[model samples]
Target: MRHPHTRTTRRRVLGALTAGLLCAAGLATAAPAAPAQARAGVPGLADGLALTPPMGFNNWNSTHCRADFNESMVKGIADLFVAKGLKDAGYQYVNLDDCWALPQRDADGKLVPDPARFPHGIKAVADYVHAKGLRLGIYTSAGTRTCNSAGFPGALGHEYGDAQQFADWGVDYLKYDNCNNQGVDAKQRYTTMRDALRAASRTTGRPIVYSICEWGENKPWEWASGVGHLWRTTGDISDNWGSMLSILKQNLPLAPYAGPGHWNDPDMLEVGNGGMTDTEYRSHFSLWSVMAAPLLIGTDLRKASPATFDILDNKEVIAVDQDPLGRQGTVVSSAGGRWVIAKEMTDGSRAVALFNESGTAQRIATTAAAVGLSDAPAYTLRDLWQHRGYNTAGTIAATVPAHGTVLLRVSADPHWAANPPAAELGLDASPLLEAATPATLTSTVTDLGRTSARRVSVSLTGPDGWTVQPASATTAATLATGRTLRTAWKVTAPPGTPTGAYALTLRADYRSPAGERVTSALPLTASVVVRPPAGTSYLSGLTWLSATSGWGPVERDTSNGESAAGDGHPITIGGTVYARGLGAHAPSDVSFYTGKACTKVTADVGVDDEKGPKGTVAFEIRADGTKVASTGVLTNAMPAQPLTADITGAQVVDLVVTDAGDGNDSDHADWANASVSCGGAAPAVRGD
Candidate 1:
């Protein structure tokens, strides 16, 4: 059972829905016994259903229940699923998400369909689906409520009864969800339902596909095999590239756990969701197909245009999902945000997807040598989406679009064929980082693509005063590109080392992958402030700036630091600066830290300082020009005063201090020596 805090909340809700139905149908009415043994020749639920890619239509991305759902929508989609050849293409299930069930269970302890929309009853809906030569899929949860706490009588204590009811309704597929089940033991909670589903299937003699949906909690791969067929390995996916990539990257390391009977479900596809451009959607489909994920479409099938229809109907791409090899792709290489390599099936051929995750377009080419196929057979290539043939002499090459991918099917050209030996060089890290002082340096070794290096040496550097530990010189072995080696270093900053700015550097060695050792570095970062937890405002600002996403960090130790770090003091009229990202040059508003009860004072501070990506250095002051506060040079430091500013009962306050080059009073002009604060009902500066 997935709690709301799990990575992907919505998918867990679906998992709960599936499990709850089985329990409702009467399995495990009492406490569980030991794990049951399988009867000879009895197929696992996953084996009987969902043996291939799970074909279904979900209501998240394309619909989201923003509008009133009706039988027309359901029947229309069922008609489209068949009319559009999707059912023939192997898509056979239709599942609804939240908002379909009523707020209360009926007298029979059975969840009643909504009277307004599901007037015909859920069983009637199931019959409608079955009449179309398709299967009916319904949603529910392990908890007593749904995602929004709407009532939908769940399987919390009545697993057996609920499972029996769903079985009686002729429900062919169940999407168990996870929601509102917090404060309960997740594993035991889900396990109880899994056992119930097993018992329900045995008693009813009906096969129900078990979907474990805890948003990958308790590491689904660790226990999902015995519980469900397909486990949601990540949060619900949105109709954007980042959402897709984030989910995909999370599933890479869990590849070994996926097999023919089980899979790493990376949520559903947003192919025709209208949130992304067509090119991005094509890339999205290619990536998911190459990953061998469940191909559940979250689009309004009835409205799918020819383009959408064509992409979904691409048999070549679909072949990758139904590959006989039954192997899920794993990420072979990653450079954080730059590139990735994933492998899958190519209809008896091999499909490799080389992706460039950068902002600008990147040309990525790999010889059979780099990816371990040095002397493989001559090959024919075809771009899956383009449906065009590609002829390669020896090397396969393509320019991946920005935030895009190139899917290639590799097989013998028949003109030339040969077997090649696999290349050998590996990389691994052990306890990658350990305890160190505030400014200690650490190192990790790398293996080169080549075997040896004539002058193999490594360097450790990051932030200010990074020192190589003990001895810095060693006659090291030639490090392969993916090989691992350790380096030790210490970071020592002199008293004069600035306290505000931090540094990040890369440790590089003069070692090349193929054999020629060259000095290339890996990047590292060192910071002065406490690390902010992810998603906090401070971290969001910093991460955005570091990515050069139009934001820059301020120089805390400089004159312009006042605005970035200042506490509210003497009344200022116009504006006060806090942090500057974009909109600095553009007209903007400022916030002030006013003490608890500071009364009113009318004034405006003319914040005229503007600088680099960090923005301008200026300040805001009271109209009378008596009180002055300044936004100093760009820096990353928090002000000595509280962030909020207050101005009450004060007639005059001057907040602007001229930049050093502005010819203002030198005493206030130099930010390095300026330490301004207010007393009493004033905002006080604790540090200079």
Candidate 2:
């Protein structure tokens, strides 16, 4: 992803960011930035294009470079945008991604639209889109050839020429792709196009929104603010539950790099696509809205049903994306499949998502204090999707269907907290923690209050003689309510820290939002028990799972329904106990005996119960980062699939249960009699 902002543009952005903090809070909204008159206020710079995440219709997802997406199709989508109420909802750009050009450049080395497809050419298409009160977008590449594989040559050596040609054709947006660039530096090649576009704009007085699509490998967010309006944060997204969720996991941490004028693009919206269920689609839209992602439409407008329009044209949710504050929502709390992601809205309120990633209906609840809904005896909550309102001042509770979301806009009076702040601490130990080796200890400090908690600090207390790092840790900033701060400490017990089950006193010190000093204490007990020497343990117990408690409660099953409503009966081998979601995303982990290499891992796995949720799951085993083995798309009624993987020379083995094509709701996946064998590198279970 190329487009680097100019020096002056960066200065203005940084200067304006000084007030961004206020925008991020519910205190105020940032004014929309004014575009620079000249590129860089100097000469040639691709200044203002998208003051917000550019939204519009893109034909690639719905048509995928097929022969059908032509001038008529593009014009039809534009008409639908107006007819279906998409135009007034802030979705204006009509972008053409890949395969839009002739296979070869003209004899004069100029690019041209395919005659067979557009008969009248791209200029006519742009005119049609402009006539409909909408803007038209075109596509190109940074390399010698485009990503279409058999598409036209890129703008590589013809940046200026292509720029001039596009200007002549009256293109309003450019989707610059990355493919076949003969080893040219990504930044250099992209910057070349930026200048090309700037020259065209200055000469023609028409601005084009440049989208950098380098696919996140170039760390575009690190240097891609002013260069373009938005940059893809990851690889292209597939139309499936796993692809959507996977991209989200990678894009969530890039939130800080997104704001007004520039954004972290997680690719286009796939709302009406048939890959995921309605519930999953809601989560997709809800996440993109709160995360400040570009709200581009990637579905066929003509075929989109009313339900699809309901999701795409939700004005209330759209307002959050178009909020002048331009702040992305962050994950405040996540446990099991229940997640709380919150965004501070402009009107001293908040837009929140209570998401259930499980396969069954779950009780999603959170207190007003958790989201900084302080100083109010009561607050009004508006359901964004259902278009209804509720009054609540305590815990906001709802039963979200499997893979469903309960999205709400809370109007809370922002003020100092009137009640004492509550604190929660979670302790996690290293999977390889042994008797003599130093292990990293992680602890989280959460302020269960309705306002910001100030001067927050936490410490862990164990036996007096234990070896612990940084006896205490202080947060660099005040803790926002519902926000959890994780601090890690290196701890070691020399067989003298009073072994066995021990309670760690995790105490916190903080001041109330009103500046009143307060102190809180919470205890986390982890067995200081000795992990048996190297080769003596199997992953037969919950203690072996790396993050057992991070999710909702997971139960070991003897019979399928023992944990939840599933039909999985433990395979009669190895051990009667099998691990499944029990209505949760049951992710488990185990380490090989440090003394030897794991030769192989074996398991009999099947989808938990198809009779009820019929949800799907994939069982994956990875040693280090190498995927050693996996059972793809496990479903109910399918015989237990036998799997094996060579984890040779690996010290850790991880079993990850992921949501199948559907959401994780009722995805009761079972790994019966799962175990790994140690051999080779060490004393191969000596045949004494």
Candidate 3:
């Protein structure tokens, strides 16, 4: 959230100009009178709904329009919400995204639930959810048909009847989408539904939380608060780091428009999706929470891992999101892929997030005074992830891993000394390891509290069947405040371990001055990687360690379209098609492990013709984080440009695509016939 003191001047100028422009464009209008208790000057429903951003489960991201998304699935989700403790964790809504209704309406012009999908009807599903102490949300479009190609009947011209039907069915939330609107004005269309919902709430005594899904094409943040409880500030989010980061950038700048009952929805949570790493998912959750966005779970709970639940069930972080102050976190400092965001809390604390967006670890730091907190001789710094409190002399700092966030709650408390003595831990070692190779891992512990600690001990543990031996002394006695201890461990991955990420835990235990035993455990991920083949190979057939795209999933040998995997045509550039290549959108990065054996990489790079003369993108090839080759800005009108890079002695290679100054719209980029030659071998020639 933007600190009111620091942003007052900028907010006044931007707010006035924005309001004036919106009113002149006829997109802004006088909002209905809010209830007496509603926050003054904020536009939203008077029904006291969505006091905090709604936490819930939505089926669209996990099982969109699938056959399994039926009555059983909906009821199962409600069951999980209770059985898995999500109910206690504050997740209340079980939403059906789309394809839950029939293609046509009944003779009375009322929407009908699909008998095939909802056997006992929508009311039964809502009742099942309500029985579990949760609310039910349903999806619809403001046009003649829903967004899905199934062409489900929408509530555009039948807003009153649809809203009434939803109320009668016990629907507690409605996600109104944009599709096939026939050129209707966005504000006029959404306002009609808002009025209808209000009337239904009066008659049925069931208020529904409204969600506006216009894809931010009309700058919904400027006019949506009066019409919806939360509004999407960007396009639909794909389960990738690039998509999440792009959406975060779009939503973070609109902080002033979100508060109390109204929020800036950057789409739903993609925490458990398989596309991104757990570290990235944690960042996704942390950033969303700090920004005060909705915490809608977008994964199947039944199939989620313990790690996924750990990220979702973080109540300390959730408290920051549900903070009654309702302030969205704003960037206090951002540069070179490092960002420091701060949110003012109601209890005179500030939630600070040190985020590392780059591809390497970075030390991000900020002062408490910089985050709108009053200065003091000492302050309390609570690590939300670690669930520990420490004393700091106003400085909040952390070495955040790539695509990770360090979330801390800082407060100038007079009783700071009453908290337990805290120690900060750090691990200085590469997280990647080859099987059966012994690597030395160093762990550092620093006393950051107000008092000294005794009997400090540190240990490193790996997965079962792996060897972990101490390389240095792991115990210390009588460590004073501000003291540091370093320990080393020789760890070896077992032979034949799978080439994937595994967990390692570094733990520290100490006796506080108050005789309380304090323990801190930090989890690290170790990835076992296998080098590429010795001969030349097409990158499309190789396994990328990680890949992220701006719009959708990265496609192999196809154009990067606006959908998930395999939803694109053959890779095409300037009307020319290629059979072997990578298709990715701008703001994309695909990394492969070469193990320092690859000699060179060659490709024909350009903006794919699928965008049809609209995209502007630049292609880059990086070897071990250093740029080895690049292309000037290329557009869809340009032919494929041949490029080659010397990747000798580079362990990893990255294929990158970036938007050229302009936005990322239609930036479908391709690396046609991309291949890497390894071990000084001759390049493999392919006929296309």
Among these predictions, the greatest lDDT belongs to: 3
- Which 10-residue span in candidate 2 carries the lowest summed lDDT? 1-10
- Per-residue CA lDDT of model 2 for 1-688, tens digit only, reads 2111121233234335433432343222222232445234332233556766788988887887789889888999999989988999999999888777888888887888888889999899999999999999888887666766364667767788888889889899888887655556777667667767877887899888888888776888887775677888876665655456656767878878888778899888889977677777988898888888898898888899888999999998888788878788888787756788778777878888888764434556776778766657656667788675544445565556556777878776333234445444545432234555677777766755555677888787765666667634557368765677777877776654433444456667777656777665544443443332333123443244232211233334432331223433543222233442222242323333322345776767766543343546787777754687988887665667888888777655666676553334344555665555654334332211
Write down the RMSD of all candidates, one decimal each.
18.4, 18.5, 8.0
**Tens-place lDDT digits, model 1, residues 232-255:** 886556555444555666776777
Ranking by TM-score: 3, 2, 1
Superior by lDDT: candidate 1 or candidate 3: 3
Q: Give me the candidate number with maximum TM-score.
A: 3
My TM-score estimates for the predictions, one after another, are 0.58, 0.59, 0.80
376-451 in candidate 3: lDDT tens per residue?
A: 8778899999888877766677767778999999999987876766676777645667899987778888776667
The lDDT per prediction is 0.52, 0.66, 0.83
Question: Candidate 3, overall lDDT?
Answer: 0.83
User: Which residue pairs clash within candidate 3?
Assistant: 1-328, 1-329, 1-330
